[model samples]
Target: MNEVMDYKFVSKETTVNEMIRGKMRNIKVITIGVLEESTGIVYPHPISEFIKRQYEFYGKSL
Candidate 1:
């Protein structure tokens, strides 16, 4: 059987200089990083447009 878990988020206030900022530039690069450290299945990208087109036709979601 599967188990469900609940999580709580704790946050604090801080200044911009105290925080670090960066960007991956691409999600593919991040995924490659994860693969380097772990073992898992990964799907090839450039997925079909059918799902996207359907979503747009009906309504786009967040």
Candidate 2:
């Protein structure tokens, strides 16, 4: 038997003074889905475009 789970990363941008004002930044939501096989192993989709985009951005920064 196997189980599957999903993960997501969300980011937000706000002014430094927002903390003093007790305000939260607008969240940019990113979702990632994973598949768990019968071996209890999880893997992300190969065709996922987000992963590719992120990798490209990271490589550029480096």
Candidate 3:
């Protein structure tokens, strides 16, 4: 089983407040695709860690 990771460094409340204040800010949501070799299928996956990292990065910049 894949272990779930907790994003301790990022603050969701702060991110939301920043977005609310930056009325014209553009927010891009990205989802990574996971490929299953056995079935030769690609599935869209949304990883919290990956997305939160972006939020954390942007939050620090702000």
19-44 in candidate 2: lDDT tens per residue? Answer: 32577554333334453433443344
Model 1 agreement with the true structure over 1-62: per-residue lDDT tens digits: 22212222222222222221563332111111111113233332232234434664576511
Report lDDT per candidate.
Answer: 0.28, 0.38, 0.44
RMSD of each: 13.7, 10.6, 10.6
Candidate achieving higher lDDT, 1 or 2:
2
What C-alpha lDDT does candidate 3 achieve relative to the native structure? 0.44
Clashes of 1: 0
Which of the two, 2 or 3, has more lDDT?
3
Model 2: per-residue Cα lDDT at residue 24 = 58
Output the lDDT of residue 3, model 3: 25
Per-residue CA lDDT of candidate 3, range 18-52, in tens?
25464755554433455554454555554644666
Q: Rank by TM-score, descending?
A: 3, 1, 2
TM-score of each: 0.22, 0.21, 0.28
- The regions of model 2 sitting more than 4 angstroms off are 1-33, 51-62
lDDT (C-alpha) at residue 9 in model 1: 25
RMSD of 3: 10.6
